[model samples]
Structure formats: structure tokens, C-alpha cells
Target: MGDIEPGALVLRRAEPADRTALAGTDPIAAAGDPTRRASIRRWCEQGLALLAEDSRGPVGYGVLEYTFFEQGFLTLLTVVPGARRQGVATRLLTAVEAACTTPKLFTSTNVSNQPMQQLLLKSGWRPAGLVHGLDEGDPELFYLCPSENLSLSSTLRTFPDTVIGKESRI
Candidate 1:
């Protein structure tokens, strides 16, 4: 889940026009759960949403914010079950790290989500601390990556003049 070889993934800043398409296909938004949709919408308002699309369409997504944590925080990352292990998550993460302009980036995963923990470790994110009572028997596992270690090319190959939206070597 951590080592992703970027392929046809097209990274783009999410726009309002994407809401319908996203809500219709994105698992969280399509869950028919008003709460999740509202939460995602709220994050969108802050312009923290990034959508990962391929020839087929949206395969993964991530949201970044500073309100929850003083540092750059990846609030949410979702990859369709079918897209798992294909480096989509890693690419999404690399995009997050590249777009982040803060001194550090922080994120958390439920204790039960072992895959995410593995991904965090493999991606060079270190365990910062933990928060209890966040989920039953599953205290949140916090991870942080200092700016010095936040190298986007380490995870995804990119051109010297590359920017978001352009394809990068896998």
C-alpha cells in the first residue's frame, strides 16, 4: 500500500463541479450517510480536497487541513477496495506531501487499520504519539513527517519541471 508506482493517475485539485461525480461514486460520499457527505463538504469548503482519477474515473481521494492540527494534516484518505495495493494511496499521499507548504505533515489512522499503519511506516512517516478513546479499543495512531524528510520524488518519480496534473515516471 505504501510503495506506489505512479501510472495513469491524474492528480488535480478538486472543484465544485466534481461534487456530483464524487458523491455518486466515491464510497464515503456515496454511502448515503449525510454526516460523511457533510463532513467532506466542509473540508472541501477549505479547499483541501484532492481527487485522484484515472482513465476509468475516481479511484482515490485525500483531504488536507490545518484546523485539526497546527501542522499540515491529512484528514482523510480513501481508496476504492478494487484500487487498493495499486499505489493509488501512495500516489495520493505523495501528492499531499508535495502540496503541503507546512513545516510538517501529520495524520492518524485507527488502530484497527493495520494497512494504513504499514503504509505510514513504509512511506517514512514516524509514529508521533497516540490519542485514546477516539475509537473503541482502537486508539488513533498519529504519524508525522518533518519537512526535511518530505520528499515527493522519493515516493513518486517526477520531472524536474513537473507540477501537479502532469504524469510522472512510475
Candidate 2:
């Protein structure tokens, strides 16, 4: 467990050992697709796994993986009970966004997950549309921001024009 803030929490990269912490949560594991066990393993192997920790261990975790078509994808994001409304998810997203220099980014959440939708919108990611049946019977909501607009390189830090599902050479 890490130190908790007075009214918030801290987010950091998760180690392989943190798997146990993640598996113990309901929303985190339950939100995972039934057939994605192997994909989860792959995400752990290659993607950036992050956790939000407070005085009570990990309360949230998000896995971000590289996509074959897009520059990157937000594979998963879950915040446990007692940690909501503290900006933990936002911090996790911020770290995820800061980790890559991709020209485009993508993430999908179940249509029922309104909090995540709000979080995505608040984080400067605009919704493209709903990706039907991508999450079992749930409609997956898509969000994206172009890398040029997402550059942290000081020079190109300004925003760029971005649209969902748009093709770009870079």
C-alpha cells in the first residue's frame, strides 16, 4: 500500500506483482471480457499497466496497450469502491496519455459505463461513436485524439485537428 492524499490518491505504473491486487477487485475483473484472458496476459506483457493507490492498496488500475491499427488503445480502466470521485482515474489516464507519442489514440468503454464516458470527455478525448458488439452485447464507445495534438514535445504541444476513425500517415 502507498500513502494516500488527504482528499485524493496517487497513480503509478503497476508491476507484474500487482496482478494479485487487480484480480481481487470485482469491477476490474468483471469488466474484462470472458474470452480475453490471453489478451489480458498479453496486455500485462507489453502494455503499460497502471494503478491508483491510496492508504488501502490499489483502488484502481488501467491497462493501455499498443494497437495494430491505431497508435495505441486504452485496453482497460477500473476504479474500485471507496476510491471514486477522487480523480484517480483521471490521473491514470494522464499517465497513459503521457507514456506514448502516438499520432492517434483509441479507447473503448461499454455504453453502460457513464462515468468512464465522462472521464474520457473530461480528459480531452472526444467520442467518435459506438462500436457495436465490440464488448460482448455492450456497445463500445470510442474516443481518440491525434498525436500531433497530443504531443508533449514542447514544440508541438499545441492542439491539432482530430477526428475519430480518421486515417493519417503519421
Query: Which candidate gets the maximum TM-score versus the true structure?
Result: 1
For all candidates, what are the clash counts?
0, 1
Scored by lDDT, model 2 comes in at 0.64
List per-prediction Cα lDDT, in the order shown: 0.73, 0.64
Using lDDT, give the best candidate's number: 1
Model 1 misses residue 40 by how many Å? 2.1
Regions of model 2 farther than 4 Å from truth: 1-8, 26-42, 68-70, 135-137, 146-149, 153-170
- Residue-level lDDT of model 1, residues 8-66, one tens digit each, is 66776667667665565567579788887877676666667887777677777888788
TM-score of 1: 0.81
Worst 10 residues of 2 by lDDT: 161-170
